[model samples]
Target: EPEVTQTPSHQVTQMGQEVILRCVPISNHLYFYWYRQILGQKVEFLVSFYNNEISEKSEIFDDQFSVERPDGSNFTLKIRSTKLEDSAMYFCASSVTSGEAFFGQGTRLTVV
Candidate 1:
């Protein structure tokens, strides 16, 4: 079966530092997205990418954040500057169509 894979299941960083979270989606999937869940909050949509461009984004994906598919197989999310409020479990997801997306286990990011 195909599944999304994220690296460094957990990460600890200092505030004001930059962090890059990575993911590899199923080979055939066309749409990719980034979602996050603060410790006690609901999962929130960050951004969605397709055809090498940003297809959609939520308020959370502000100027400080960016995403890329550096290689055809890998997708990444970068936070220009980490903040205490940025601590959360970030999930990478993908889907063949725009409907339901399959998510990676999630990468827990902690900023001190």
Candidate 2:
């Protein structure tokens, strides 16, 4: 089965630095999303992309954060300025429509 893959399964960065998390969603899926889990907290949606544009975004996706699908096979999330509070596990997910999302293993970002 096709699955989403994220690179650099784990990353460590300094506060105020920038970080980019990469992912490749299932080829046939239409909806792509970025979600994060901050330590013990529940998974939270950050943004959703479809048709090469942002379709939805949460309050957390402020100016400091951005997402892109640079190519059909690659999706990425960039944090311009990493904060200690930004440390979390980021998940990439895809769905054919708006239902039944498939997720990547996740990339854990640790800010020091």
Q: Give the winner by lDDT.
A: 1
Top candidate by TM-score: 1
Count clashing pairs, candidate 1: 0
TM-score of each: 0.98, 0.98
Against the true structure, what is every candidate's RMSD? 0.5, 0.6
Question: Which clashing pairs does model 1 show?
Answer: none
- Lowest summed lDDT across 10 adjacent residues in model 2 is found at 92-101
Give candidate 1's error at residue 25 in angstroms: 0.6
Query: Which TM-score value belongs to model 2?
Result: 0.98
Model 1 lDDT tens row, 1-112: 8889998899999999999999999999999999999998899999999999999999999999999999999999999999999999999999998779999999999999
Where model 2 places Cα greater than 4 Å from the true spot, the runs are none
